[model samples]
Target: MSWLVDKDWWMKTYRGLIVKSMKLSFEMDQQATDLLSKMLDGRGNVIEFDEMKNLFKEYNESIVFGCGPSLLPDLDFLLESGNLRNKLLISADGATSVLINHDIIPHIVVTDLDGLIADIAWASLKGSVIVIHAHGDNIERIERFVPMFKGRLIGSTQVEPRPHVYNFGGFTDGDRGVFLSRTLGILRITLAGFDLNGEPYSCPGKLVPFNKRIKKKKLEVAKTLLKELVSKGVGFFNVRGEPYVL
Candidate 1:
């Protein structure tokens, strides 16, 4: 039988496995929260929900770009597609550099401050809404980079969201871009540069590092989440070579 025929069973099984691993994840998130608290310490502005809603009021379609190596070769096609003009362009952190290099600035960027901070900050300065994520593993990064931003900022957390921080339900930066678009009520979302089967691209040395095995696992989780979103009526299209449908 096809896996889709037993979707409920698979989802339950995945949830059970993830639940067993959530403790460690939660502990790390708590640690990151503590660090973020220290970093913000009365500084920096968080975008309110009303403000975010207002920003996306006119947008209905979004194109979310991931930073898998395959993204580099596909950039030309994406730029030439001509469909980008009217759609809200959302870039996963690392993909910001690529987009910037191609003179295509995203309307929003989802990052863990793990990619090139300079690129992300530049994009923010150019009017891209920066959705920065806080997690235990990137505490030092948040401390170092958060203060460097001078444009629109939105903070997200994996745990409970508060006044300045929000949680939209995603694990990595790439998937977070989708979550952000979905949360904003985008009617359609097209994904590009998402090669879940391959290794994650490496960023600058000072940026957050990448581990192949960990990234692969994260991609699996992302795929599962994307599938869940599909089951819930969210419209998703994959522009990469083969369409990745739920």
Candidate 2:
């Protein structure tokens, strides 16, 4: 009886973990679906790229830039240096305009619209691909803008309501923009100004806060996923503190 009791407890605990993981994964999937639906309501489904063959095309030499405050100082230099204009640019959420203002158009923009509403008008105007990560909070926005976007919109889902956007219980989406770059099969990636620390950088009256704990973890998760891809000879780069391999 004692052994059976212990066995049952262990089984329950293991089952609980499995259940949690499944729940999170489902939630993430749903979030991605909702965001994609909004961004692509009229645009239609995103074309599935051939990850195997296409992965080698232009991405082998591509450089991906994540938007962060640290990037502000060197934004001009980076953009003007012309290191990655031909290479695919993956703009993280809220950084879309920053890149745009500098005339450094990202091939794709990633965000859940937390701080991107203001830029939506111009971004949509430029006709760049936007990947919107969906969450319950933004359903109304999705419903409203999906019809308006009328261009390339990719959606991402998430497992948990982002910590910043929870009240009692609900999910909040952030820029899983890096994922957009990956989906495009860009094996070579560069992450700049992606500092995880929460410091403040200013532009006009606005301040770009550090609060990248969430982003950091998300980026780490992305790195792990890319590792498997890299081992198979996929080219990869992490341009954070120093250029490193995935």
Candidate 3:
């Protein structure tokens, strides 16, 4: 199938899924939905879709960095290659600190605010628009960190997108970055620090311990989601040193 055709079909399917999920959320967790709605009620400066579209208008390629153990190593190579300047840099939550520490500010940071709240805040302050996700599991996190962000802020939700919150169709921060890029019609996407088969590491900027089982599960989901995008004719490339299929 042609990419144009695939894009149309995938988007239609995606919207249908979002509608179904929203209906289910309302049915199964009305209270949680209500709580999230309230939390986002007074929030101003929410990013709009056209704003994001304009931000990426000039770019045809993007590189999304994940916080997997291999992120630093993979980033080192990309930095040396000097090709990063031509592509938008997107960091997935925990990877935000790594990029900042290396003196590279990501154009966008996607987070559930579970990783490195302070660093994510710093990045936001540095002009990196933060795409903050709000779900039932992270309501407290949202309440704690959303107010602390000092710069551009965008809200995302796993449920139905609301007045301020939008859904681009991804579960984890890394995949969300990819989803956002694809949604914006980026022609090519390169991934770094995404090692689904590598060793798990602790979430950056946090004292919480790492759970290999959970990390593995999330990686599986991320991989599946990315693969689905690829199957729908989106271009995805892995720049990790070691061979990574899919």
Q: How many residue pairs clash in each candidate?
A: 0, 8, 0
Best by TM-score: 1
Write one digit per residue (lDDT tens) for candidate 2, span 187-210: 555655454344433222222243
TM-score of candidate 1 against the unseen true structure: 0.84
Per-candidate local distance difference test: 0.73, 0.47, 0.74
**Which prediction has the highest lDDT against the true structure?**
3
Report RMSD for candidate 3.
5.1
Worst ten-residue run, lDDT, model 3? 1-10
| 2 versus 3: better lDDT goes to | 3
RMSD in Å for model 1: 5.9
Task: Indicate whether candidate 1 or candidate 3 has the larger TM-score.
Answer: 1
lDDT of 3 by residue, 102-214 (tens): 99999999987788888988998898988887766566776677789878777776555565567677767998898888878885888888887666566666535567776
Off by over 4 Å in 3: 1-37, 40-44, 207-209, 240-244
**Greater-lDDT candidate between 1 and 2:** 1
lDDT of 1 at 112: 86
Q: Report how far off residue 19 is in candidate 3 (Å).
A: 16
User: Against the true structure, what is each candidate's TM-score?
Assistant: 0.84, 0.60, 0.83
| Residue-level lDDT tens digits of model 1 in 190-236 | 88888876665564433645676666677887887788778777787
